[model samples]
Target: MNRRHFLGSSGGLLAGLALPTLASAAVAAPSATGSAASSSAGGRGYRPVVTLGGRTLGFRLNNGVKEFHLIAEEVEQEVAPGMSARFWGYNGGSPGPTIEAVEGDTVRIFVSNRLPEHTTIHWHGLLLPNGMDGVGGLNQPQIKPGETFRYEFRLTKSGTFMYHPHADETLQMAQGMMGLFIVHPKNARERPVDRDYAFLLASYKIDPGTRRPDPSEMTDFNLWTFNSRTFPAIPPLLARTGERVRIRVGNLTMTNHPIHLHGHDFRVTGTDGGWIPAAAQWPEVTTDVAVGQMRVIEFIANAPGDWAFHCHKSHHTMGPMGHGVPNLVGVDQKAATAKLEKLFDGQHYMEMGSSGMAEMQDMAAMGSMMPLPTNTLPMMTGEGPFGPIEMGGMFTTLKVRDSLAPNDERDPGWYTHPQGSVANKVDPKRTDGLPR
Candidate 1:
């Protein structure tokens, strides 16, 4: 069978088997209501899906169905504290707004195309009629600029999904046209979570002197983001200790990210296909989210502290940097610096990369003496209590504390450790090596 036919047949077969199980589970579980219930209106009772600097899209009730409105437009967004880009996105922000819905409910999403180009929103990983699957010409007509398109469908299953343009997908998605679409289970009390959060991993390659992101870039991306914001600027996730936490991660970047969380071991609870069976779940401290994929990780917030949550790739933690710089490690530049300094009377040049490369970050954080190219983020930004953190992209902190409010998502500042709980400087005079 061809690809389309295969997908159609598989979708039908899965729906036939899955719908009954989902329905039976709904009947067996007690009806959840109020704040604990998953409702189409207001997403009440559901743990708020944190989007960092972004906001969730709200809906209005029309008869029994939920109605949502979206607008595609050009946006100038700050990817980090020092970098901003002009890109096309839905609503007013890049990565758009989070769309929340409940299973078994019909949702009517009206997308108004205000972008300069025609577009269509493909409901990634959603089960819907082929006609409602918003592919530009394959499934439906393209939503031309200045036109509005409506997609009405019943959510058959609840899971983490995404929405991005299928028309001119390469350029549109690369320019930042995407959003998170979450479907809460009809039987809300089945799997309970105290704190739920979601973020999309997106990367961009903005040429050093330009403010626009290049959609044609397939590799050598410079800017990395979580919901389009870099570390320090990316808001910290706050939670009370002992609470059940769920983090929904979606990767739209060209590369995979091994997201690591300090102080906790989490389980791969769900994926775009739906929740993983309990028997199949695996515990991991780091989970690799691959391109065009979604991963839902869950864990108990038993540790109380500000823990680092970031991509395990060391280079991914840093911001936009020159990839062409020649390796200077172990190279003696003292003579060259001395001659340069003498040539330029009052100038002093500092050699780098002998002891370590940390000084480069220190210099960048102190503000480069020379102005950086437009739309480029400093390779290292954000200050820590001790000194410069020397990190930037795809980084944030998961702050778990006993004193934090259950629903509080604000930054609680830095953690204060008890006396003797933190590492201290050691004296060399008192230390004697037993073995060389």
Candidate 2:
């Protein structure tokens, strides 16, 4: 299997999201430069969605209708550094390019199936004619291999929506065949935002040294991801301080994720149903996104700092690790280490988790830990300014800075604190009104 990594730039430009083999790769989304996704459409301003490690699907205006193309194909998705798996997705990437348009716009999506099996796309949460429902046999025909099909619908309302295969529903989606479909209101001013971002939540059970995701494993998913990529490998979302940032998250995995963000109290401004009324909106630091659901949260980026953003589930924030390992905490491994060292010529002797698993990460970081299998990532890894971040999986930072240029999606790096603002250690023996 070939190894791959996500595309990122050192400067302000954000790269497009698509594997090399995508059919519609020519028409890619705009590179992130720190600007709202707004454009002039029919004399009205339209804000385009920015997908994390993905592209916003572009369209062609033909006779007043926006036309888009989708190609269902195989993709080798890099879950994180040193880890990857074969997945099925649209336009050559799992959690395919985001489909965006405006309310009251007539959009025609041409889906071409290039996979070995037949597939059909179900436009989740869109009100349309029953024939356009795309439920394989229930309403429409399955798109056979090498065959193309079209789905046309009028956008009756604007909200957060999604699209996935309703054909094999099980094995297909389990292999990561999903994407977001966002419809901006006809009037961009209705729900204006400074920075709008989107991503899909997906989980896969891929064993170390393997190349394909185990679609059959439901309860034992070991890889949790945002936008088909993991922490350290996933890029941070950038924003200017005091900007109203909107993050739209869609869940396609079997499980739910309680996404939490540090430093801000946001409200669920929108759901799959529609935008929530202001009176009904409630402030929350974390929101639970269930399977086949979507949530949109918005907040003012008043705090200029790198805020931790991730799933609340502790296990969901870790990479590949043995779940059946024995509990060795507090065990006396001094004698065992000697015996094992002599048996293995003192080369393979090491105490694992004798005190805690955190030490294991330190050992690994120092290159003294046992070797991991090929294509495997450390369970807990990430270097921070102070020390190790001690996190993985669906983890990233919302970097809010006071000096980011408009649409400059470049990482602003670590936040520097002012004098007397950082926590300092106090002498334990003689401390006066200081932290002890």
Candidate 3:
């Protein structure tokens, strides 16, 4: 966190500070509205929806994942064309759903607090039990708002894990609530792969004059993501040239992500639970994952096209903070001004000035004024073969495939393409063959 604790945290200079009015309010909800907020008075009919290959297990909240209470509304469509407006979600868009479960099963949930305060539900790196380890008031109590907790556990370790609001978790995970859970380890063995994707690396910090979506109580986080959209927004990762994929990396912020992938070099094989005995597999090409970490990679899609994964730090691939403001050329403005002048040595980046003025700068000078951006490093980032490189902040990609096939072809017209289909066009190879 830096820019001087992002401006001196209470939610940084009172920009919106309401952690239930500074903690201890525990539970609340009453503003009477639309059918008293349906779901037949607090939902969770609980059902794995369908189950296994039929792929099921649906949930929202039943309670205790660390003081639960997710509920961020504000509808209104049209994401482009005139940019329609009204965004923000939790049970819906802006990164919310994609739960799926398997491993040792059991996964029950219930969380129902239509919003107003008191929240919980941390499950960042799954290994449940200490009261489902959600960490609100340090294990339980806080669900308030409309009250409805019940997070049952049991998925003994899985590949990717994440949930949010461990009570003010860096401003309710920067106002979005965050998501993506996936477990699937009842034995997904069948190597040489085919297709499987799940990514949730994150980062956000935008206030270069209220351009909106900014939440840094100071220090790290400067917008960088995937699954919350960032790099060219979303594209790559499609494979079919020699298939063999399975990319499930996770890194739910606090910073630490070194993920590099101009072409290919994977085979870490499971961590956080599910496979790692094949003589302890290891053949990286650039990995480094910390902060609430996770890894279960496996590549061999034989480079088919559209590469450039990301996060190898270098200013998280660039494109913000005054876009090109004072950058005077390369190596990220001389390594962010020599790591912000070895983190001070001469001080002043926010000793408080820029007006709104004085009396609030001392979380250690707002956390050393600035320099936490080696791609946001906190829960995981990857780069430990010899240390000093962890900047992946969690990444994406791994689309190799030519026949390790298995699209299961589940209808929906198999993904309608027609109108000048371009014969499935492909040609960008380079997981290691060259010619991206």
TM per candidate comes to 0.88, 0.91, 0.30
**Residue 435 shift from truth in candidate 1, angstroms:** 2.7
Q: What is the C-alpha lDDT of each candidate?
A: 0.78, 0.82, 0.49
Cα lDDT tens digits for candidate 2, 64-146: 66667888999987888777889999877998888877799888788989899999999999999999998999999899998
Model 2 clashing residue pairs (backbone): 33-407, 33-408, 34-407, 34-408, 35-407, 37-47, 37-48, 242-301
Q: Which segments of candidate 2 are over 4 A away from where they belong?
A: 1-28, 31-37, 41-43, 430-436
Best by TM-score: 2
User: What is the alpha-carbon lDDT of model 1 when measured against the actual structure?
Assistant: 0.78
Q: Whose lDDT is higher: candidate 2's or candidate 3's?
A: 2
The predictions' CA RMSDs to the true structure, in order, are 9.5, 6.3, 20.8
Q: Report the C-alpha lDDT of model 1 over 121-143, residue by residue, as the tens digit.
A: 99999999999998888999999
For model 2 the local lDDT of residue 411 reads: 76
> Candidate 1, after superposition: displacement of residue 67 in Å?
0.9
Clashes of each: 1, 8, 72
Question: How many angstroms is residue 89 displaced in model 1 relative to the true structure, after the best TM-score fit?
Answer: 0.5
Whichever of 1 and 3 has more lDDT, that candidate is: 1
